[model samples]
Target: MGEVKAIKGADWKLEIGGLTELMGEKEGPALLFDRIQDYPPGFRILTNVFRTQKRAALSLRLDPNLSGIDLLNGWRMKLRTFKPVPVSVVEGGPLFENSMSDGEIDLERFPAPIWHEMDGGRYLGTGCCVITRDPESGRVNVGTYRCMIQGKNKVSVKVNKGKGGRIAMEKYHQAGQPCPVAISLGQEPSLFLASMSPLSPEINEYEYAGWLQGAPFPVVPGPLTGLPLPATAEIVLEGEIPPLESKDLPKEGPFGEWYGYFADTTVGEVPLMVVKKVYYRNDPIILGVPPLKPPNHYVSVPLGAAALWDQLEQAGIPDVKGVWGFVYSAQTGPFTVIAIRQRYAGHSKQALLVASGARAGAYGGKFMVVVDDDVDITNPYDVIWAMSTRCNVREGVDLVKGVWTSPAEPAIPPASRSPRGYTMDRVLIDACRPYQWLDEFPQVNVFPKEYKRDLEKKWKL
Candidate 1:
């Protein structure tokens, strides 16, 4: 189902990363690299696991034939049925086929790639899951945070402020205790998806993964940290993050982000984890999901838009047909589009306003557009055509300032950014025809969909 190739360690990073970028451009198959320049024959790395709709659907246990907004809408309905499926604790599994402790630890034994030329160091945890528990409620949270190797037994984790893992770690540190952590380098695809989802703090990711897969996820207690580790994981690292001042923490990141830019690198800003134990299968496969530039995303479908659609409906905007995003991240990013069937004079504008500020569409957002239901929101051409024909420049666009955004946004001036948080302006566009003049508006020159389908059937074209 994918390509397997051998690579030399001297030029491994560049070759692998270059190949991944090229394949992403063309929507290519998964890549499996083995026989490294210095590593054993069976040691390997896998990438592009969810780059195709078929693969993404299969990973989430959904029907593979679904595509576009239909697929996302299916997931949205599934989300409504979510219930916590507690994980199963197994005593042992393939994850413990081999083990290493303090004196024998050497992270370099496994190949960590420099996915981008500008990356400050080798990142071993791009696709990995960082597991932490809240000290106050004992609630476990699994998140996908970048981890870069600093030493044989140390990896600095970039847990951004306001993330569940970061909040949990800060709580432990405030109590003068070390925050226990477990890093799973590779595991079932459902687990990885749940780790990166925008789940609420009260929901445990392990349970969410179980719900996604329709079965209880199996995990084992870490030998040292007692944190849950994926029983079938390829590699697992047990560690703890102790309270330390900014000066004492190691430098972390200038890595390429999903937003298609290298975020600012900081010195002594990230938290450092001291690994105490390592467990792995006989021949581990590291899941490498390095962020590529815009138009080449890690996940093919606009999954985030599904949540936004749900929020728009909940906000009381009626006749919502679909939602799609372009150049997106975990949530919506630079451009988000909403399709709705106009029911009243102000229906379209109401959707534009609510979607631009809704919890699911607000973060990392730049442009928000609302189009009529007839336009294919997933197609850029269709969306742009609606804007050109229906919207009056003077009446359609509104800019909202000081909106919520991430620090990775390159548009934010360095002088304007504060250690506290980041914000940016969002432009909301109404592309639907003016409902006030509904009966007087010009009709689109196009064949009806049902009539076109009938012609296609009769002509056999």
Candidate 2:
């Protein structure tokens, strides 16, 4: 955000769709107006924090031009050795420059933007991280979940089933207890990155943030919840998620998701957190990151790609070259691509099965394509070309059903949907040449080096 600001950031006009509604639909890096209207000026809004891979890399202190696999691989390597530095408590940082506690909690007074036109309500936790604790292990969990304001001190939240935050909350439900939680906004980018990362269960995201920035992720305890929070955060809301019956739960969405579509207005009745305490800097900034569509994968793709690639390698899938959950699907769903140098008859299939069956690919996965090393998984055109010529639909396609997916899948039969989970069909396209034809595959058409050089000199085309 500072980098973009230094370059005199561009203005993004708000119209019928609302201030942040059209942000996800844009294609390139344009750090636009975060706080446009329906809010005060002292409180700012930081939008498009991770809209492009270039900005993402620069925000993480990587080369400004670093992108795709290079950017992802660099972070993946650092993630392997995340020795999390314990959060240190201090008087407080910028986060506690002001205060709102006890009966002072006021949701409407905050500059929370109503992003999309079709959203159920104003969302406050779009770019924030929710902190909770495991009932059994007491391990701290930080997750990014959609939070919608209900009343003055109330907000509803829904988390994906397989998420660590959900798991922690479920543990509380099992014990018949309310879960304590803290949601932080306008915090350090490293903290947000770690919260969104697909890290191993054993690794805490705080440590992951430390590894990302080569320093500890400074934090202080929430006054009400005692959960750690980014010390320099712009605002903090501490509350408890009380386990409630269906009739007592709160409705959360109808908001635009990362997939650019609104499948279900509400995931289900979710627990509402009653804010008991609030802390903020003098003129707080609300970190707004509303999910809209494709270009939004600046967060999902690079990290998701590297995490899936690492998992495949750990599973002993040899000859693997690259993997990506294309931005077209927000890094989830059927568009996952894996590039491999097929070494044997069924080597490619083995890679396919592991990738499809793994937790990462288990949800919203529709089409998983296995391409040869010569094809670039990052390039959709390259992947499509390989699919066109190297694969025969009848012989190369493999179908796998009963694969787990989010209930938000629009194509799922409504009768088959359940609050527990849902299943999506998956197809593997073996976009590689026939392994039997070892020596006789047709060579790709290309100009010879001298001919290309001469053509380059003679024509600007």
lDDT of 2 by residue, 1-461 (tens): 33343112222222423434444355334333434455455666666667777677766777767777778777667667657776666667888888887678888777665676677777778888888988789899888877888999999877767779989998998888989999987788888887876666888888777767777778887777778888888888988988887777666677777666765555346668888888889878777777666645436344676777888999999978888776433234558889899888888778888999886666678888998888877788899999999987888899998888765666788788676767888898888887888468898886667898888889965
Model 1's number of clashes is: 0
Q: What TM-score does candidate 2 get on C-alpha atoms?
A: 0.90
* Number of backbone collisions per candidate: 0, 4
| Clash count in backbone of candidate 2 | 4
What does the lDDT come to for candidate 1?
A: 0.87
- Could you give candidate 1's per-residue lDDT for residues 310-398 as a string of tens digits? 89999999999999998887787879999999999889889988987887788889999999899998899999999889888899999
Q: What's the distance in Å from true for residue 274, model 2?
A: 1.2
Residue pairs with backbone overlap in model 2: 333-364, 333-365, 334-366, 334-367
Q: Which lDDT value does model 1 have at 434?
A: 88
Predicted structure with the largest TM-score when compared to the true one:
1
TM-score of 1: 0.95
